[model samples]
Target: MRRRKKKHEDEHMDESWLIPYADLLTLLLALFIVLYAASSVDAQKFKELSQAFNEVFTGGTGIMENPSPGETQPPSDGEVKSSGAEKEEKKEKADLDKEEIERQAFLKDQEELKEIQKKVNEYIKTNNLEVQFVTKLTDEGLLLTIRDNVLFDSGSAVVHSADLNVAKELSELLVMNPPRNIIISGHTDDVPIRNAEFDSNWELSVMRAVNFMKIILENQELNPQWFSAKGFGEFEPVGDNGTAEGRGLNRRVEVLILPRVTD
Candidate 1:
């Protein structure tokens, strides 16, 4: 029997829930990646990254016109040049300060030397020793000149007992200050020497310098290492040897106190 066609019910698909589940999984994965990336950001790099994003999204608008509190822009060329200029200026200022310090020290040394000169002149005048010894302050420093009559006799190297006391007193006064090079230069007249002790004026001058230096070294506290004894002989004679007066002036010993300076 041809029964009325049985009406079959349409089966409903249950896959509608799978679409929302896949979409949620995708959104969760993206959120986890963003959280991980944000967790590792530091201050400076994060600032720069924020600035880059702001510039990209601002579309050249008011948002990007002024930098935000946490945004850091790249260093401009002007800033870099200014930084270099500041360093160079600092170096130049340091050099100028050093030079000024040195200049002040030199001036102070000159003043001290001048005071010492005054004291020395006072002593010479008070003791009536001007005839044998003369002192003056020059650009070189304090100059103490001793004639041959006070230091030696003809070509003798031995210092008299009287001069020994003078040398000792000078050494004591000199040791009152810091150590410096003390140049002891000996000069003589051009006349030939005919003495048994010295064959020529050079030997006589050298021996006299040594003998005088020895007397000065009587002070145990004085440093002998700073002393220099040079025999200028007749070459550095202050006066001509042609006349007796000039020869007398030439026969002398000079003690030079050098000025303080840094090389």
Candidate 2:
């Protein structure tokens, strides 16, 4: 009977160790579960998981008490560099888009100016005024140059009585849906003037520009605010001041139609 009891006791085989072994296995399983969840869960969940681990471990401390690998951290150098590159790429794209828009606007403005120039050229041809008038489309805008003799006598600022009809006809052409700013500038040859009516060439030039602008503003359809007058006496010349033909070209009144885009 004693031998049989001893055999039973030996067969018991220290089963108490199984409790700690099972606890170790449970801890390992929980650790693996936490590791897997940390990869996919948000920071709040990760912090909750850490708290659970601390409660399960000794003295409210555990390996998970430290930050999770997936938790918020400073950006790596490569990530920072990539962010900067993306910002720069976006800026370049925006600049390219702006440039394309400006290019399209410039093309449209050029076409409009060209159309106006063509109309003026047709008018000049129909009236046989090519010798006294010229039109040019430049970067500044449309420039319509009329010989001084066409509108005024030598050293005079008045538009000739016969030319009043011409001025009125020109004013009729300026009626537009959206009015543009017009600058009437008078230019003169280098010849000095001291007449009874005018003290100097500067005064004569100024009067000519003012008179031409007044004639243009006489049209009820035209806005007086859009018209301005200036004088460039013997300066801003387009021709040589020494030659007769060049002097004839220089002594003119210029009508400059400014682009609407500038406004």
Using TM-score as the measure, which candidate wins?
A: 2
How many residue pairs clash (N, CA or C atoms closer than 3 angstroms) in each of the candidate models, in the order given?
0, 0
123-188, model 2: which lDDT tens digit per residue? 899999999999998778999999999999999999999999889988887776678888999999
Candidate 1 per-residue C-alpha lDDT over 1-263 given as tens digits, one digit per residue, 9 for 90 to 100:
87798677897878999999998997687567534534553545544544554565565454534545544456779999999999999999999999999999988988877877777777778778889888877778778898987867777877777777777877776774677778888889998897777888888888788888888888998888888898888988778789999999999888887778642
Which whole-number lDDT from 0 to 100 does residue 239 have in model 1?
Answer: 80
Residue pairs with backbone atoms closer than 3 Å in model 1 (clashes):
none
lDDT of 1 at 85: 99
lDDT of candidate 2 at residue 152, scale 0 to 100: 98
Model 1: which ten-residue window has the lowest total lDDT?
Answer: 34-43
For each candidate in turn, the TM-score is 0.69, 0.75
Off-target runs (Cα >4 Å) in candidate 1 are 1-81
